[model samples]
Target: MSREPNHRLAALMAEAGASNKGLAKRIREGAARHGAHVGTTHVSVQRWLDGGGIQSQTASFVAEALSAKLRRRITPADIGFASAPPPPAALGASYAASLPDSLNLLDELAQHSLDDGQPSEILLPDGEVDSAVLSWLVSRPDGLPVDAPASRRVGMRDVAAIRTAGQMFMRLDFLYGGGHGHKALRHYFRQEVLPLLNGSYSAKVGNALFGAAAEISQLLGWTAYDTGNHALANRYLLSTLRLTKVVDSRMMGARILSNMSHQANYLGQVSRATRLARASAEGGRGHATPRAMSLFAAHEARALSSAQDYRGAARAMNEAEKFLEQADTAQDPDWLSYMDEAELVGEFCHCFRDLKRGPESVRFAERAVALTDPQYARTLGFCRMVLAQSQLLNGELEAAVTTAGLAVEGGDALQSARFQRYVADFQREVSVHAENSAVQHLNEQIRAAMAQLDDE
Candidate 1:
């Protein structure tokens, strides 16, 4: 006979600060968020508490919802796999009260992807609970014993080295594609960086190293996202957040939240995206520089646009512009330097395109294309596609065809599925003017490009 699953639902519930009723309510709410329907009832929740297993599909839903609420990834094993280790001594009331937010945040960060087939928004709950918990966790002092051996003391020099290496990796990643640089960076981090974190460092040195490691881990997540590996990206992101807590860098934590907001917007979770972006803006208030603030505002505007809140979006954009105006180059974080006026305007153009404001999109896109570096070929290609779309909408078929040709030329160097979608969109628009030789030729070329992509 098969062994009965070790059901730790009661323990898990306690750790989450959830009464049976609260658990039921969260289940219903989570279901609704994911476009499912599950009644909130004592009996339904009781089954879970009583150690009765749910249907596989329902289990997945419950797991996802609970994970979201807890802010960490909660596997069936976490609740109780068939055979599992005894609960930890720390798995008590205090731990229970904070577990939900941690699990939820982890889950939210862990599921992002940049794949073409993926939706363009990520849904996140309001930041109220997450901000509070993360703030407290990150602020705690490193409690390494004073009498520890010499091997434990990580020096400032070591921390500096790690930071320098991480900065180098970040620059390379931005210049090359993520796929080109990710593997070596990850390998170095795992082999060289993590061990130092485990060693005996002074409190100050340890915290700095931890912060550096957390930032690098976040870069790994970004690389995974860029490569279309959603699951891996999610894992890396979670690890990054966890490390940030150990390091206590509030600014870094807020930056990660902003990144999550960007991923959510890309995934079509507009409301969730807005919530995350707003949380990022609010959380980073004192800790982040003006450049970081501008980027956060831009993310919120992008989400608001996707949610069809044109006025709200426009207001956010305006605020972002104001923040950008105040940004001092020397004072800004290195990461924020890439987000210049052109990048901000490019985001606006994309937002306008999402909102179907073709003329506005075209105007903004033209400026963005003019300002962006040719080395940023993917971004340039996307701007061209947006311009072509705007021209098509304005009945300038010839102009649209010409712009799309330029986009295609740029696309030839990109390996992104999202970029291919732009090509498809351009082809669809050109199909209306198929009687024109230029349109016909462009369509044939697009089809041929798509065929080549398939072979690759």
Candidate 2:
């Protein structure tokens, strides 16, 4: 069967005199303004022009780029993608009130993501975050029990296996980066986990299964975020949040929202990031462990730092530290174990670096470096880059070059696009000192390291 040609898109491209390559270039450049890096190629543009659909996030980027060039309000619909639904706002659905709807929505989302393949770009819209948080807060816990068909039965052993697999994948992501194990997680969910959801189980077992699924989903979401698939990450996080509500797991839900906040902050949506972080804290009001609170506060601090509100950032950081002091590992959830003082100090390093407090940034970065595990390649590299950046800004050229070398050494071993972006930013910052021999040599080393990683 042949599909219809996108006459509207072809006509618009003709009117704008936009060659496929030209359009792709514009879209890629435009996407950066929204804090997204799109690998838009001429082939992508050709597909769009041939009546093939693009991801909603990419479609929005396309419309915006074309609208700017053509001086018209071009939309997804205008370009023959009106029929394609937008990326899901799944987190906003009230799990208790709409159990069946939420489950069906998640099922649809999983199928849609598989069908669309990996997204080439993502647009982090503020409205989506606000709506998700608001809906989560107002919703009640699910009262209705799951009624799986009286057929094949699921047991505690099955749930335990899922949880164990999730932990294994989480460890892989921590050591090797999210791109290392995200596909395996997606496959496990689709092949192994989905069947259990459809299998028969008592209400007690069903709750346990859903809770385990939520944790796995959250990891899937985190891995996607680490790999730079922000839109996919958001969808998975939303599903996790909804599942958390279904299981009445407030602490876990707060953790999910905190992850969402981290992504929002990365995308430069500072205001939305702050809102989500605060909302997460609020959601975890009674149940959040001290470690969890520390994590939330640190995220809030990052958002404040991004907005250049140094005092607010400082207060949030203090709160995080206070909470960390009170944290008891045994009382905290397993997920909260990683949110230790080292991580908090890394957040401080990030905050100070963003605020251009060179000495403070270096101090915290050094502390974080000492405390961070060697197995956490991506985190260590990020902290080193921040330290190098602080050294550069503090006018310690030799130390900056040396620290940058260390960063690149670790970077070469990781497969994280976020790490690459931060390194790129560091590269651009150091390029200003191109007159120095040490700076030039360090630049070459970094480029070579990145090239080796790419080739591998």
lDDT for every model?
0.64, 0.77
By TM-score, how accurate is candidate 1? Answer: 0.66
Writing each residue's lDDT as its tens digit, candidate 1 over 1-456 gives: 444433576667676777665665566445545654333344555655555445343455556656877788887657754342331222111211232343333333333222211221222234533544355444563333332565555788988888888778776655444554676776777667766765777777766777777777788777765554443554455445555655456677677777777776765667767877887888778877778888888989999999999999999999899989888743865555678888888888888887888789889989988988776666777778888888787778898898888877654434543455566657755776779999987877765654443344
Q: Compute the lDDT of residue 281 as modeled in candidate 1.
A: 85
Error of 1 at 7 (Å): 40
Judged by whole-model lDDT over C-alpha atoms, candidate 1 comes out at: 0.64
Question: Ten residues in a row with the worst lDDT in model 2?
Answer: 88-97
What is candidate 2's lDDT per residue for 125-218, written digit by digit as tens?
Answer: 5675566677788877875365646567888999999988987887888788887777678788877887687777877888888878888878
lDDT of 2 at 328: 71
| TM-score for all models, in order of appearance | 0.66, 0.80
